[model samples]
Target: MAETRPVWVIYDDGSTGHMEIPEGDGDPALAKPGRLVTEAEYTARLEEIRAARAARHEAEETARLEAARADYDALIAGGFPEATARRLSGYQGTQAPAA
Candidate 1:
């Protein structure tokens, strides 16, 4: 039977988790009092967190762009200067589209 012992884990975000310690690392009882995690576990957790953060950032950016587009559309419809409209729309301060 494979021997397993509890191990302490401190996550990158200052959190903690515990897992079975590998055999031959002295002993679980003798292990240091610090965070511990398997390579696979750590990688999976980090990737999951990164993916979530990326998704949130993308959503926020999309919302911001949409708001900017709406404001630009309103300005263009209201007869604002073409250069000003394009600038507000994040364009290169070029001429606006012909009405």
Candidate 2:
């Protein structure tokens, strides 16, 4: 049977999660009071966190782009110059459909 232990984490963003880990290195980012893991657990957790972060970043970027597009369209409707609107809104694409 594999060994496991209870670990509580207090994160910087005022968040927390439960882990079956042990106190090892004094790393703040790992686990509160810290925790150790088996090679298998480490690898699996590493992949999981990476995938989660990537998905979150992609979603954020998509939202940012959408907001920028909205801003660009609003500015153009308000009679702002294209260059000024693009500059302020962070939108570089042409507003009209291709010919």
Candidate 3:
């Protein structure tokens, strides 16, 4: 059986969590060093970190969608066909039949 030890994590945003260090001493690239904390504190901090990440991801996706819409509109205004515009804008909808 491999041995595991509890360790604290300090996230990039300054949030902290307690996690078990996997056997083989953990991957330095994947783990950040921090002072150890109680299990309860770790759980609470982990929730906060997850929530913050979700919010950030949502914001990024919204921005990307908005930009694609703008690009599609611009392509249409520039005389490109609707199907071509959508394709160039990275849209995944069914293409209209060629007239």
Among these predictions, the greatest lDDT belongs to: 3
TM-score of each predicted structure versus truth: 0.56, 0.60, 0.63
Q: Candidate 1 overall Cα lDDT vs. reference?
A: 0.66
lDDT string for model 2 (4-93, tens) is 666554344444455653445343357344354455655666577778889999999999988998888888888888889889999887
What is the number of backbone collisions in each predicted candidate, taken in the order shown? 4, 2, 0
Per-residue lDDT of model 1, residues 1-99, tens digit only: 778776555555644466675676663442345556676766676677788889999999888876766777777888888678767777443344545
lDDT of 3 at 79: 86
Clash-forming residue pairs, model 3: none
RMSD of each: 7.5, 8.3, 6.7
The numbered model that scores best in TM-score is: 3
Per-residue lDDT over 4-99 for candidate 3, one digit per residue giving the tens place of the 0 to 100 score: 877665666576755576767844343554555566777888888799999999999988877877777778778898889999987543544233
State which candidate, 1 or 3, has the greater lDDT.
3
